[model samples]
Target chain A: MILTVTLNTALDLTYRVPALTPHTTHRVTDVVERPGGKGLNVARVLAALGHETVVTGFAGGPTGEVLRALLTPLPVRDALVPTAGATRRTVAVADRATGDTTQFNEPGPHICPAEWAAFLDSYETLLGQADAVALCGSLPPGIHVGAYAELIRRSRAAGVPVLLDTSGEPLRRGIAARPDLIKPNADELAQLTGAREPLRATRDARRRGAHAVAASLGADGVLAATPDGTWQATPPAPVRGNPTGAGDSAVAGLLSGLVEDLPWPQRLARAVALATATVLAPAAGEFDAGAYEELLPRVQVATA
Target chain B: MILTVTLNTALDLTYRVPALTPHTTHRVTDVVERPGGKGLNVARVLAALGHETVVTGFAGGPTGEVLRALLTPLPVRDALVPTAGATRRTVAVADRATGDTTQFNEPGPHICPAEWAAFLDSYETLLGQADAVALCGSLPPGIHVGAYAELIRRSRAAGVPVLLDTSGEPLRRGIAARPDLIKPNADELAQLTGAREPLRATRDARRRGAHAVAASLGADGVLAATPDGTWQATPPAPVRGNPTGAGDSAVAGLLSGLVEDLPWPQRLARAVALATATVLAPAAGEFDAGAYEELLPRVQVATA
Candidate 1:
């Protein structure tokens, strides 16, 4: 089983409005909601692709309940720790007239020390049963910045490969523990490597201690650096739709490739193909099996 | 006890972002959720003012649970009938740079036949114990436009005065029941009365079967028409700030005045003062006690 950790989960709300004007009341024509957090999103795509996955993280208040309830019908196993603060909500307002989307994100629940301890207990139990773990998304308040680093170290000690996906300080601090894999988008890679060149950033990330570094470069596709070699995988063409969750889709693809025992180049190819398909999917970050299967063999992978 | 009905309740979310751009991912800086729906808002303000208030409406799913949870801590009584769908969410994105707000409102939950029946039961039970009933907000899907008409007739039959606050077809259908008083903002009144002049429109509204009409005219204050005569209430100055809930606050003021047995002029003055104070208050539509006190004496009610 694969475990995905989301420290900050949210109720992702998408609203369709005629237009967004400052301080104007709007009659949102439509609304759609789903359980969201980086890890939850990854787990969702994994479950949709017929993978056995368990999601763990901190959730609280009514928003937490909304997340849990939303997850009940899905195939993924949920083992979220309850906290005192309400989970955050991210509102995406899509303007019908201009296709403009305005986003408003809420900081997720604050996890107390006791709640973190409880999570540790649950995570340890789950980690013991899991073949691999994926630490994903932003850290909630009251959490030490290096919390992901500790998780990476613990996963290594437990002999389970860990995939680290986060941005900024947490990602910077986490790489020191040397996780099996790190996935950062181009911008995040730049911030980490201070390099404008994608390939140089990939090498910098790998050199920073990760066994391998995978960078998702939007339309340009995936760039991978490993001790064995460096490679770039790009889809033949870009698919269109909501690109939301494409990275998480890539994470799911990476984890799925690892579980399948694929080579680095093959994994890179598969991840890029899956992400491309996800962009084409109606909702962001999900790919249909038929489209994914058709696109996998066509992705172009290049060795450095 | 005063009973307020919110057929479509919501979890109102406010998001503060530096600037909102279209079709791009944004990092939202702040989020806040509060119980919402015109009637629920009115009930909250009434409770804060020490009124024994009961809020009965259709609410369901996890968001509905949150709507109920938010009310649990307040002094108002909850009589939410369960439904199949989650109550809607309204998101307001405030752009700090432009000092503008863009809103995305969700269409409310769809109420099934059984849910409608449940609300009727709750409304009857609460109305039996209440001195007044206020039917507020837009009609949710699956509820007949004339639903408020039935409710208004029931309240009148019980010798209880009802204040109807709504717009469009629901207001059009509800007015036939001759609710003791109807409060429509100038625009709504114009749509209902077909008169460009608000005073003329208000007089037209009273002729359309409403026993009286209280018309809110934004900066111009309020104009009220009764069987006895028409009166105009003006504030000393325009109140500034978010006007989100000012309408509900005015409804609360009117109800308070009626319950206190104040003359119509005094009620109009109180309503105008409260509405002004509410706009200036931190949360739109909620009047701070101090602001209410400061503004009340300054509201001038003159014969029209």
Candidate 2:
């Protein structure tokens, strides 16, 4: 089973309005909610792909209860610890007239010391049954900055392959623990390595301590720098749709590929296909399976 | 005991951000939530004023649970009926840079026939022990447009005075039921009576079957047309703050004064003072008790 961790889970709400005008009242025509967090999204896609996955993190209060209830029907196993503070909500207002979205992200709930300790125990137990682990998303309030690094170290101690997909300080520290793989988007890659070019940034990222680095360049495709060699996997064409969950889909593809022992190029192909298909999917962060299947063989992988 | 009915209750969420920009992401710096619906707001103020208040409405799902939990610490008694559908949420985004608020109001949960029948049973039981009933706010989906009219007629049959506060078709149909009192803001009055002149519109509203009409004229004060005569109540000066809950506070004052047997002029004065104090209060829709007391004696009421 694949294990994923989302420290700062959220109840994502999407509101559709006729139009968006500043300082005016809007009658939201529709509202859609989903259990959200980078790891949760990854686990969802993984489960859809017929993979056995388990998700662990912190969830609490009314919002947390709703998120858990939403996950009950999904195939992913829930191992979330209960916290005293309520989980946060992220509102995305979609304007029908302009076809644009305005996002308001609330900060995550504060994790108490006891909750963090409880999560650590749960993660260790889950890792024991996991073939590979993915640590995803931002660290919630009251959690130490080096949380991902500690988790990576623990995964390595247990002789399990781990993938780190996060940004900023957490990503920087976690990479030093030598995770099996790291996936960073173009922006996250630049922030980590201070390089403008994708290939250069991916190489610089690997030098910082990642065993391999896959830099997702949104539309352009994936740039992978690994111990074996460097390869660039490009989608056949760009797909038009919401790109909210594309990166998480790529992470899911990569983790599933790693566990399945697919070749480097084949894994890169799957990752690119899943990311592209997610963008084409009508719902936010969900992939179109038919599109994924069709795009898989079309993805071109060549030496960088 | 005073009974207030909120057919379409909500979990009102306020998010504070540095600024609001179209098609961009914002980090909400602060979040605050309260049980909301026009009737709920009125009940809150009435309870704060030491009135024996009972609030009945429909609440269900997770958001409803949260709203009920929030109502637990208040002095008011909860008589809300449960439904299968989840309660709606209204998000108010306050932009600090412009000090402006943008609102997104979600449509309320669809009340099934069984649920509406259950609510009727509950409302009838509560009305038997009530001195007055206030039917406030919009009708949720699946509820007939004449729901308020039916409720008003039932209140009359039970020998309980009923006050109606709503807008559009619901107000139009409810007025024909001859509620003891109706409170309409300037715009609502104009829409109902097709008269831009406040006094004329108020009189016209009374002719349409409301025994008494109190038209709130924003900063100017209130124009009242009752069986006794015509009267105008004006505040000393306009206080600047959030006006979101000012109307509900006015409703509370009017209802409390009615139960206490205050004279028409005194009730108008109390309503105007409470409305003004709510505007002066820092929190949305909550009145400052100190300001209410200070402004009460200063409110001027005279024969129109």
Candidate 3:
């Protein structure tokens, strides 16, 4: 079973308004809510791919309860620890006329020292039974920046491969723990390694400690640098749509391939195809199965 | 004890952002939540004034649980009935730079027929021991538009004085039921009576069967027409501030005066004073007691 960790889970609320004006009242015509956070998104995509996935994180307060309830119908297993503070809610107000969205992200609940210790205990237990673990999303307040690093070390010690997906200091710190795989979008890759070139950044990231690095180049596709060799995977054509959960889909593809013992190039091709398909889906983190199947054969991977 | 009915209760969330712009992401600097609805606001103010107030309406789902938890700290007694759907949330994003607010109100939870019936039974039981009942806010979906009318009749049958505070057709229907008192702001009164002038609209609303009509004229204060006489109560000066819960404060004043058997002019003066004081307070539904006390003696009430 795959284990995904979302340290800062959220109750994602999307509100559709006729138009969003800076200082006016909007009667939200529609509201759609989903359990959200990077790892949860990855878990959802993995579950859709028929993978057994368990999600572990802090889920507390009313928002946490709502998030848990939303997760109930999904195939992903919930292994969330309860915290005192309520889980955060991210509100996205979409303008129906302009097709523009204004986002308000609440800082997630503060995890107390004891809660963090409890989570470490729970995560270690989950790691024991996991084939692979994906650590995703931002560290909630009160969590140390070395959180992902600690998790990676523990997963490595448990003889389980760990995939790290985060940005800024946490990603930098976690990279030093030498996770088996790391996926960073172009910007995050550049920020971490200070390399403007995608291939160079991916290589620098790998040199820093990651065993492998997959750098997402948005519509251009992905640049992967691994122990075997470096490869570039490009989609048949640029897929234009909401790119919200495309990265998570890519992560799901890579994890599935890794567990299946596919070659690096084949894994890179699958990741690029799945991400492009995700962009074509109506909502984030959800990909059309037909689109994924059709795009799979069209993805081209070549050594860089 | 005063009973306040919030047919459509909400979890009012206030988010503070540095600035508000369309199609931009905002990191909310602060969040404040309170139990909200017209009736809940009234109950809060009534409780602050040392009145024993009971709040009843639909409180369900996770949001309702949060609202109930919030209510636990307040003096108002919670007698809310459970519903299948979760209570809605109203988000107010306040721009710190401009002090302008952008509001997004979610359509409240759908109330099933069984839930409505349960609420009616609960309301009738509470009315039996109430000095006065205030029917406030919009009816949630699945509830009849004539809900206030039915509630007014029931309160009358129980010999409990009922105050109706709402707008549009619900206000018109409830007025026709001959509620003991009806408070309509300038727009609501105009909508109900088709009269732009406050005094004219108040008189027309009274003619429609409201025993008393209290018209809130925004900065100009309240104009009241009662069975005893007609009076206009004006604040010392136009109070300028957030007017979010000013109306609810006025309702609290009116209810307090009614139970104390104060004359129409005195009740109008108290209502006007409390509303102005609420405007000066930092948050909605909260009044500066010092300001209320200082303004009470200065409020001018004259025969209309």
Candidate 4:
């Protein structure tokens, strides 16, 4: 089973309005709620792909309860530890007129030291049953900066392959622990390595201690710098839809490929296909099965 | 005991951000949650004013549970009926840079036929112990447009005075039910009576069937048209803060005065003072006790 950890889970709310205007009142035409966090999104996509995925993280308060309830119907197993503070919420207000989205992200709950210790205990237990683990999303307040590094090291100690999908300092520190893989988007890659060129940045990130680096370049697709060879996988055509969870879908694809022992080229192809299908899907974190199948063989995987 | 009915209850969330720009992402600096709906606001103020207030309405799902949990610590009693649909949430984004607010109101939960019937049963039972009832706010989906009118007629049948505070068709139909009192802000009054003139519209509203009409004129205060006489109650000075719950505070003031058997002039004075103090208060739905007392004697109630 694949294990995914979301330290800062969220109740994602999407509000559709006729139009968005600053300092004005609007009546939302529709509201959609989903269980969200990078790891949770990865687990959801993994489950949809017929993989046995277990998600562990901190969930608390009313928002946490709602998030857990939302996750119950999904195929992903819930092993989230409880926290004292309320989970945060992210509101994406979509303006129908302009097709633009305004996002408001609330800082997630603070994790107590005892809660951190409790999570580590559960992580160790879950790692024993896992072939691969993905540590994703931001570190909630009160959690130490090196939390991801510790988790990655623990995964290595257990001989389980781990993928680190986070940004900023967590990614910076976690990479040094030599996770099996690290996925960073263009912006995250730039922030981590201060390099504008995608190939150079991905290489720089690999040098920082990641075993391999897969840098997402949005519409340009996934650029993978692996030990086997460097390759750039591009979609057949640019997909037009929400790109919110496309990267998480890519993470799921890469982890699934690793567990199945697929070659780097095949893994990048699957990652690109999944990310493209996620963008083509109507909702975030979900892939169009037909689109994924259609795009799989069409994905152009060539040496970078 | 005063009874306040919020047919479409909400979990009001206030998000403070540095600034609001359309179609951009924002990191909310602060988040504040409160039980909201006009009647709930009135109940909160009444509870603060040392009155025994009971709030009943439809509350369900996770948002409803959170609203109820928030209401637990308050002095007011909770008799809200449960529904299968989740309660709505209203997000008020406060932009600190511009000192402006952008509001997004979610369409509340749909009250099914069975749920509406159950609420009616509860309302009738509660009316027996009530001195006065306030029917406030917009009706949720699936509820009849004449829901407030039916509640007002039932309140009258139970010999309980009812105050109607709503807009559009609900207000139009509810007025014909001859509620004991109806409070309309200038825009609502203009919408109902087609008169931009405050005093004319207030009197017109009374003639349309409200026994008394207290028209809120924003910073100018309230113009009251009652059976006994016509009076204009003005605040001692322009008090400015958040005007969000000012009208609900005014409703609480009038209802409390009615139960205490205060004269028309005194009731208007209290209403105006409370409304002013509510504006002076930092948060919505609360009046500063010190400001309320200081402004009470200073409020000018003169024959119109």
Worst 10 residues of 2 chain A by lDDT: A92-101
Q: What is the lDDT of residue B83 in candidate 1?
A: 88
lDDT of 1 by residue, B1-304 (tens): 9999989888887777778776666777777778999999899888887899998888888888888888889899898888898888877777767556776668888888887887787777777798888999988889998999999998988888999999999999899989999999988998998998988899899889999999988878889999878999998987667777878888998998898888999898888887888878876446778988988899988998
Per-prediction TM-score to the true structure, in the order listed: 0.95, 0.98, 0.95, 0.98
Tell me the DockQ of each model, to 2 decimals: 0.64, 0.92, 0.79, 0.90
- State the DockQ, from 0 to 1, for candidate 1: 0.64
Judged by DockQ cut-offs, the docking class of candidate 4 is: high
| Fnat by candidate, in order | 0.85, 0.99, 0.89, 0.96
Candidate 3's DockQ is 0.79
Ranking of models by lDDT: 2, 4, 3, 1
Residue-by-residue lDDT tens digits, candidate 2, B183-271: 99999999999999998999999999999998889898988999989999999987778889999999998899889989899999999
Is 1 or 3 the stronger prediction by DockQ? 3
The predicted structure with the larger lDDT, 2 or 3, is 2
User: Which of the two, 3 or 4, has more TM-score?
Assistant: 4
lDDT of 1 by residue, A197-249 (tens): 99988998988999999999999999999877889999988766667888999
Runs of candidate 2 exceeding 4 Å displacement? none
lDDT of 2 at B209: 99
Pairs that collide, model 2: none
- Could you give me the TM-score of model 1 versus the true structure? 0.95
Range of the 10 consecutive residues with the lowest summed lDDT in candidate 4 chain B = B278-287
What does candidate 2 score on TM?
Answer: 0.98
Candidate 1, residue B114: Cα displacement in angstroms equals 2.8
In angstroms, give how far residue A116 of model 3 lies from its true place: 1.8
